[model samples]
Target: VLLGIKMSPEPLKKKHGRAAASGEKRSKRKPKRKETFSVYIYKVLKQVHPDLGISSKAMSIMNSFVSDMLERLAAEAARLAHYGGRATLSSREVQAAARLLLPGELARHAVSEGTKAVAKYTSSE
Candidate 1:
């Protein structure tokens, strides 16, 4: 006795919309992520106030504040470098920019801390 049955010799291929239509395989790659300033904000908040908790709204506000400050500082630093005709912006330009951006005693404190940080980083290298 003989019964007829038919099947393709090739295994079935898994189909993706565009890839299948084009006869192309999907790439196996992880996506790159954009940088966020919130991580730095969280770290500093944790250090300054270990028991403190921040609301989402408050965190968002802080994120914007930090971002705006950085932008202003960078702009000022770049302007200083351009005015000085330097190809590279040095720590001195950054310190001057901080002073111009910040006011009075706060400016002095920030400059001092920045100087110490730069010195430590250079010494380590």
Candidate 2:
């Protein structure tokens, strides 16, 4: 049953085609190069703990975590923009997305930091 609707199961049929019956596995794509956000992460880490050192493995994990978070934020912001009948994502959408994704004080801090960064960047230009 799907969504409260009962469904009958159909017998599975064997697929016959060169694409399916070739018996040859598709070649795996080459792996992407490891992207390191090490420099930026290290800078922040240093700020938090002056003498702290991070391992390459830790850096890799941090990079993956940060990249994943940023991707989710962008996707959420895009969704917010689309929900509001807009084609382009703006700062407000991003801020709203952050609030939705982050918990309480974290969202406030993130928004404040982002605002300050944007202000500094705009003023510098």
Candidate 3:
């Protein structure tokens, strides 16, 4: 038995221009430059630790930390992707990057080991 269904096919409408097809108004506005990794990390830390006031010294240290981490991650990600014939990075690749950026050999090794533990846990689930 047929249910209560309207099975008539609707007519297609033709579009006039590219904007009409996409339904967005194209503008001459240029995209804004993204804030660096340092800027973003600073903003988040500031929010969480409000008493740690934003100062040149604080900003300088935090910015340097973030910049180093991001740069290392980028380089490691590129290397990993090259082996796979890809030119982009994954979250795991970013972890490798973070490990590379850590200040001391001990810290870097610790981070790498931690990352493996995390990956194992995530993959198991």
Each candidate: RMSD? 5.4, 15.7, 10.9
For model 3, residues 75-94, the per-residue Cα lDDT tens digits are: 77788778878767776666
Better of 1 and 2 by TM-score: 1
Clashing residue pairs in candidate 3 are 73-97
- Tens-place lDDT per residue, model 2, 1-125, is 89985565984345655353454465566999866788999999999999989999998899999999999999999999998999998889999999999999999999999999889999999
Among all candidates shown, the one with the greatest TM-score: 1
Q: Model 1 lDDT vs. the true structure? A: 0.86
Q: Quote the positional error of residue 18 for candidate 1 in Å.
A: 2.5
Clashing pairs in 1: none
Q: Which of 2 and 3 is ahead in TM-score?
A: 2
Model 1, 28-67: lDDT tens per residue?
7687985667788888999999999888888889988988
Per-model lDDT: 0.86, 0.88, 0.69
lDDT of 1 at 9: 80
Which stretches of model 2 miss by more than 4 angstroms? 1-34
lDDT of 1 at 80: 97
